[model samples]
Target: MAEFSNSNTVIVAAGENLPLTETAVKAPACIVHREGSGLVTLRGLTSGQCRARFKVSFGGNIAIPTGGTVGPISVALAVGGEPLTSATAIVTPAAVENYFNVFVAAFIEVPRGCCVTVAVKNTSTQAVSIANSNLIVERVA
Candidate 1:
């Protein structure tokens, strides 16, 4: 299992995407973690013999525009820059609340040498001030 986190001080503006910039746990070379990109690559897995489970999360206060309706802010796992829509979480901020947390988890199997990348995308309309974040990847089979 491997883990990564951020400085808890990164602010994500609307229409901007940023990667969490810290590697807290060092795993096997097959894990292939990239610095600053926040992308963890899992390779060398034989089909039907290996399964990887990963989760990504971020928590903070959201700033919603005044008089504007709530919008869906989504977080998902991206494999090679393509997001897996089936495993995603969306959170909408209302005027009654300011703090929010978004996360998504997926268990998947890949063929040998297939590069799988992981990151978080704030697919929403509100600006987020991320206070803390984490990503954990583990091999299940």
Candidate 2:
């Protein structure tokens, strides 16, 4: 099995997409992705290997806005614009500007030739900041 991975140390604003700009020095040909992109396309999958185990891992420091009373964050893996079932990760912050270490990881099964993405949703009523974040994707046979 070939594995392709990328990451970016950047902030994902509220209700905005994330682009993993840092491509790996060594990349696999089967997985195609553009630099500074948020989508990963799978290629060259046969019936025997139609299903791939997709692993998404990410972490960031976050801070809630002043007078915020809502919950933390929800992270998940989505394929073809639909979130996977039972693949969501949640993190809750207890204090203000506490440098919370929020890490979310999901392992999902995807068919061949599908586009995968990492999604972060804010559950709080106030705006939250996610900084110094990175996302990594891996394929498992």
Candidate 3:
């Protein structure tokens, strides 16, 4: 039987459009997202099945209109700047001012030395606030 391993969890509090200008610092266990760009890059991963999970809590003060998009939050898993799987959640009129959590998971192929990143973006007219956000990656194989 093969032993399974999990990577360290990376977290970001503020949920904003990550800048595409800078790269995050490299780490052996886990990589943290950049200040402007909400992306975490991991290196030296094995090529196999890996599970990625993300959770985000967000809310706004303004009431969301019926059928109107208040806040749209998107999380994605990418390798070499290409997205493999992505999930998006939007705040509806019923979820205004309340903290909502968005969870996404997927099994993907992680290539060795390939930069793996978790990114978040918010596309809403109103100002959105994120209370907490986190990402976890585990090697199932």
Instruction: Write down the lDDT of every candidate, Cα atoms only.
Output: 0.60, 0.55, 0.40
Candidate 2 worst ten-residue window by lDDT: 1-10
Better of 2 and 3 by TM-score: 2
User: Can you write out model 2's per-residue Cα lDDT over 29-130, one digit (the tens) per residue?
Assistant: 546667666666554344677676756666665665455554675544555555544554566767655456666667756667654444444433455655
lDDT of 1 by residue, 24-92 (tens): 887666577667765677765554544444343333334343444566655556666666787556667
Clashing pairs in 3: 18-37, 18-38, 19-36, 19-37
C-alpha positional error of residue 111 in candidate 2 after TM-score superposition, expressed in Å: 2.0
lDDT of each residue in 15-126, candidate 3, tens digit only = 3442333222233353444444545554434544343322222211222333434555333334444443444455453464445555545544435555455444444444
Residue ranges of candidate 1 with Cα displaced over 4 Å? 13-17, 45-70, 125-127
Cα deviation of 8, candidate 2, in Å: 8.0
Best by TM-score: 1
Off by over 4 Å in 3: 1-37, 47-86, 123-126
Query: Best candidate, lDDT-wise?
Result: 1
* Residue 36 local lDDT, model 1: 70
- Return the candidate ranking by lDDT, descending: 1, 2, 3
